[model samples]
Target: MVDVKKTSTTSQNVLRAHYKTLRPPNALRGNEVIILRHAETIAEVFPDWIERCKLDTTQLYPFDLNMPVRIPQRPNMKEAYMHDPPLSEVGRIMTQIFARELVVRNAIPRQIYSSPSLASIQTALDIKNFIGNQCGAICVDESLSSNRHDSKYWLTEKDMTRLRYCIGEFCVELQTEKSSLNDIVQDMKNLVATLVQKKKQHYVVLIVTDSLAAQILYDALSGIQSSYNEPLQQLYRKAERTFPPVSSTVFTPSTRNGILVMEPSRNSLRPLTRIGETTRPDFDSEEYVDAKP
Candidate 1:
């Protein structure tokens, strides 16, 4: 299992620093975007989930007269191991703590963007529930989901790695317009641009996503340090992915007047793919398959 990261001092410092910006005494406040990593998942918290997953799925489903109705007999064990697993009991409590931190800091967001992964959405939802954000304020962004090109970035498979059910879906995968590291940066740029344009100044927005994706967002928008020598993606790959559950970084877009325009030429970006799409892969076909070892 990938090590779960604890909340960092730096993020806490940013939260401390950001509290002042939210209530500035001057003109209308600038856009404050808080990029948050999702909380711990069932797979991350429960060792027994994998043990239950190892049972033959077909035989397990047929209910017996002696079998208790709860726990392992439930349909979602395979589904939980197969698809995006929801939060565990511990994970739910962690989210509550995270939500309360936001309230205490006065960092309530006007709008929210979330990755489509079940865990990411659940994390976003818990925060919204705490602060009373309407459904309309939250959106599931395809760009914010796992990077379409990289199998490593895909969700749900992490807990099931080397397990049987995990292998099939990824065995033949189709890559998409979100093709490279540059595309990751571009997608986040577009996200920031859209929110900055749509919402009024001082509107706070929250983004809930995976940690590596959050790292990309942070490195792209927060500016790389002066001392780092490697290329951005190289540097990115080397950085540790672990971060506290629901860890966040607060940023205001680097702006000229009020908005920050970070658009690359339309030609540079992939033809826009709609949300909730699942395209098939023809492994035999000689399409643009990114088959890297």
Candidate 2:
């Protein structure tokens, strides 16, 4: 368990404190699979504290981190957080530092995939900026989305538009229903294949997703899915009070021959499957299409 009490509750500590999780010994490397939980959102679903779930512009994030806490107000034009809430003010800064750390580690991802949520996309974009254009439009995958199964709680139309605009083209959001663990494995495979097609120099793929979603991939890679769901430890690994708050899991054999790859790590690993409907938003309506890149 990470000791959140030792340091100030500021968001920067969230990143710096987690340093123990990524020491060079087991730190990220080329041709590895990085399953990361998205940064903090304006309203967090799985807040450190359970009471934050209230609509007090504070509690909403604990239950549905992607959704913000809201109160009754006069009907007016919505802000970015109204649809699919983006990262909080602190989350944005934390993510920038996280991206820089990845670069410092020489673990810059060749391709970045994200859950179809503003928070996840926001994290992916920051890494994209630090790593360069090799990351084309952030691959938005439904399979990598939050465990909140209801579309009503998912990204809004405006959220999708922002996503489309962020990617610089029509974005194809894969739709899914109750995806099993293997579903994510398949997505990893797709990413692996794409990474393989690229030059060997390009390695490390980042999947910016929810804590629950990231755990699914981590368990699949580490072969610990059924071991025990250790609370929220999926994304935040703890140490003997000496380690900082930790985040990140690198899949073994995530690469073979200097390219990304995935295979069964345990006997329980399931076969991959192709699931979900494809929804492509028109880029013509994108207001930023005409803007310089």
Candidate 3:
């Protein structure tokens, strides 16, 4: 059996120490944001989909994570819109285990929000149910979903390759005249700021979202700027190996005084700062992107 108290205490101490030097300049230092990735999907369903489409996963490199093997040519708006997949058996079990840990620590969130995507919704519901909290509403927001921009469902191999490098760059390259990259970035920042404000009044805010949104939000909160000129492969490789699947990132407000950030680290929700400081890159000058090409 895991010692929930000891583990939570140790994790909290580690985070408090680490963030002392690395906290972002403008972050909401005292508030806490928990970003959780949805659990693994049912492998059988995806494999069946791939077989039906005659897609090849072998073409992808081992390091190329999160690239869809196949995309629907004519994706149904309802089906393709963050198509909700039920969690795998393993995903259910993982959530239960983590939920138990949260219960033991009395860390059940005051409120829970999830991406409109089916998998994310299920993950949030499972956690709320296991924690036995009926008072807190588990609301679904489309903004949290990856389809927030109403972008297409699938991407070409070249696009996927580019995404593997830097998601920010992918956003820049894939931006349509209808949706500017600046707008997307600002929207994300706004969402984050709104959540932080909510956390100020409430105890903790839990956001269950997709990997791409999770990564982008994490980078934003940490104030790690991505360069348009950096080799996409280099950035992709670094993030792929450094982070774990089903991992959690905690964002705490920056503070000068040493007030310990007390949060339980259950399951994959460990301190991400241990990975190292995310460097700030210049994004303002269009010259950065032009210089690389």
Candidate 4:
């Protein structure tokens, strides 16, 4: 997302070449990890080859279902009108696509779980209908409930806007260890302990919750503790409540069964290789192109 241009064309070429030969990061190489989006949908974002390489078909699950699929503000919105406030028409379609994508590609998991939220529940049911009910799909809302502070108050559209502002401030502040990172950290720990304990060697668990809650929980699983390595609860006690949209990231633990990591495309995530702070090679350098002309 950050497009910091190279200082020179030569540097740009070198960077491109570097990528050509470089690999991807696999922090969770062998096993699966806690998902922090609408839940299992995070896996929907990654290509199937990545899952195959990691051999982690069974150990995938989301925390909850996706609700309010189309925020009126979203661009190119599909499934705009539906009885359910959550899960737009496009959402249902995309979710089905998500399921078919997995099934056609042989990425179906042995089990599925979701939060009790209206959206999460609907998403799970939709997925269940696609693959049949025997895939072990169910709703687990307790672990994926709204934030504690959020529970204390009602949310209005204006409140949602302010909450976004607060979340941005919180993200920046967390990076700096400034004032309100503790609660965020604790919430994360609770989410991780729950998701991790449920994992079998090949188990995939999806615990869908609100977006900000998901991010906080996922961050916790990555072992990102605060300045004192203190629990997130301590931090939460000091900060105000806020909600943010979910950002997606995939994490695979070590895989002992199926393909754990693959490089289908050059842009794909390859196995771990350390080539820090290196520049790419120039394509036009005598080695590439028809210099005869």
Give a tens-digit lDDT track for model 4, residues 1-293.
Answer: 64456456557566452336555332233234323234223223333322332323233222234322223232211211111124444356655655554354333444554543445555655666787743444534334543433222222234435434111111101112222445544544655555554554564444445554554553454443324344555433221122111222344443336623211112211111123411111223321143221
Q: What TM-score should be assigned to candidate 3?
A: 0.53
| Poorly placed runs, candidate 2 (over 4 Å) | 1-29, 45-84, 134-136, 156-164, 168-175, 179-202, 225-246, 252-293
The best candidate in terms of lDDT: 1
Residue pairs in collision within model 3: 28-253, 29-253, 29-254, 30-253, 165-232
- Separately for all candidates shown, the number of backbone clashes (residues 3 or more apart, or on different chains) is 0, 15, 5, 50
Q: Highest TM-score, which number?
A: 1
- For residues 139-233, could you state the per-residue lDDT of candidate 1 as single tens digits? 65657754454333334344334322212222222335656666655776666567657644666677888766775665555443223345655
Window of ten residues with lowest summed lDDT in model 4: 165-174
In candidate 2 the C-alpha lDDT for residue 263 amounts to: 47
**lDDT scores for all predictions?**
0.51, 0.50, 0.50, 0.38
Per residue, candidate 2 scores C-alpha lDDT tens digits across 141-221 of 666664434334455546557444355344445546535444545664454455445524546677777655654454445
Better of 1 and 4 by lDDT: 1
What number of backbone clashes does candidate 1 have, counting pairs of residues 3 or more apart or in separate chains?
A: 0
Candidate order (lDDT): 1, 2, 3, 4
